[model samples]
Target: MKLLIQNLREYLRADFHPRLYLATAAWLGLLITLNYTFDLEDVYIDSLRGSWKRPVLYILLYTTVYYVAMGLWTYYHHRPDLWRNRRFWLHTGVGWVAYGFYAGFYGYNRWSEQLLDGQIYLFAYYCLSNLHSLVTLVLPLYLYYRFFDNGAEHFYGLKPKRDGLTVYALLLLIMVPLIAFASFQPHFLDFYPTYKDTTANEFLGVPEWVTALVYELCYGWDFVPTELLFRGFMVIGLSRITAVDKNQSGVILPMVVAYASIHFGKPLGETLSSVLGGYLLGVLALSTQSIWGGLLIHLSIAWLMDGAAFVQQWAQQPAGLTP
Candidate 1:
């Protein structure tokens, strides 16, 4: 912990550019949230099944705006310097990877008729989901470049260290019980009252591997974007706003709130789980300075939980198989 503080100090001392990057991102996010709250007029739901649209356009538009706003804000704020740095490419590349993971998988699911079918609602959900992904990827890169890249001190007093083994061990320990519980007592945990009992085979009509891949591509992909938004972007962005010396507690506040708010309509148990999960991810992001770790964990959990449901359903089929 002492070493972490020392490293953070070194990173922050190197570069301290208080541009509109963080503020712009926050404002855009606020705009979308507010729009959703007030202009609920645009919302659309399927008539028969009451599903949202396959790919919610409003949501996508909002997300696109947010990403464009952040990019433009960053480019304008640090034009000459950012142009000169090769790290810009690295940052952009990472952002694209994150985006691809989000859009490709989600898009596939949207195409496969697995997602909500109400056009407006679907659009909103997709947009928000993608926005979350974009924030997660870009926010950290922004912080790393703005502060840590130049050996500057961080406000959160966090230092990035690569302790792969420790991370694996922690992840394993945390996940083992969850998996066990889900297997034996799936009813004990219900994050969303609207939960669907979807199975890979039933949904995709294929073998285990193919069904798993499809499921992962569609549902599992959203995990990355979700983590990126709450844990990656919100956490780091808030840290920058508050400054590091304010204490670790302050640093994680935004992340926790954002994480919980994202699940506003979810069940109490789910919301509670989200709070705990968000905090855990925030800690991991802060400790490692790598959103990738959180993303991996998020994706893994999603896959396991969703996959388990599929497996269970498959086991109960008349032929012990999916359609």
Candidate 2:
């Protein structure tokens, strides 16, 4: 952890620009404010649900928002070469497309599929929702790695690293209390323990824990592709196009802004926290040249949040509160 902190401090000392950082913060704040005030993301996505046009529209929306932030970074950093760089285009293009499919991939009415009614329907809904990242982000990006980016970047940081893992474990431990505190907030409780409102265990003739385990596992697994894409591809993979040393490379901010845009539809506090979280993870992933540590920490906090929500609900059961 000390090493990580030193690396981050050094990197910031070398790269930090007060005006640029503040401008990027304002840009991100404006985007978030506009989206929330107008309900733009929800309105756009919900209206296009179930249509092939959904992802298409999302590509344009995400790309515009992302690049404008990147363009802002470029203007202040004065990286005129970035406009001429082919890999920048490649990273932005492929990334926006992958993100488009993933974010636009809400569950839809089955046009020809078998109808799964009752608790089974809700179970299937959560199951597919959590695991869609495998199809939308992981598979496409892996293909990009195998073909276009073969032998570069440890396959977008998919390879594991054992060093400094103890720090990641300690970070996860620290998040437990924070997550527990969040579980008490009305807004946080509303969206957490996402496996609620279902009794599909009886439908499957198994204990409730069975379905809960499956949902939680899939929920946690979604972060695998998420970390792989944002920190791995956007930060690490995108860095491959540059000639600067990793510490001096100008990648984390753009990725941080782009990553935060995806959280526009989430709770306001959650969306806001994503900026800080994404920036820290981007720095750590670049410093380590591996997404494993960030992935471990990201996935652990997520599971801990759900676990806190679950324990809170259980504790309330004896207080005359209903599940």
User: Among these predicted structures, which one has the highest TM-score?
Assistant: 2
TM-score per candidate, in order? 0.48, 0.92
Each prediction's total of clashing residue pairs, residues at least 3 apart in sequence or on different chains, is 29, 0
Residue 242 lDDT (model 1): 31
Model 2 per-residue lDDT tens digits across residues 1-323: 78768878977986788998998888888888899999987887658888888888788877887788778767877787888988778876898899888877764235112467665887877777777787778889888887887548578887888766776777677777777778999888888877775888888999888999998898889888888888888888888775366766678887787788887777788888788788877887887778999888888888888888898788878766665
> Candidate 1's residue-wise lDDT over 1-323, tens digit each?
34434534643343223454355446545644654565422333112122333124323433444345435544543433433546444443343444333333343234334454443343334334434444444555455558644533442223344544356347656876766566445553343112243343444456546534543465565565565555554455344443424332233533444454444343334545775566555655655656666666676666666556655655657974444
Give model 2's clash tally.
0
Quote the lDDT for 191 in model 2: 83
| Candidate lDDT (C-alpha), each | 0.46, 0.80
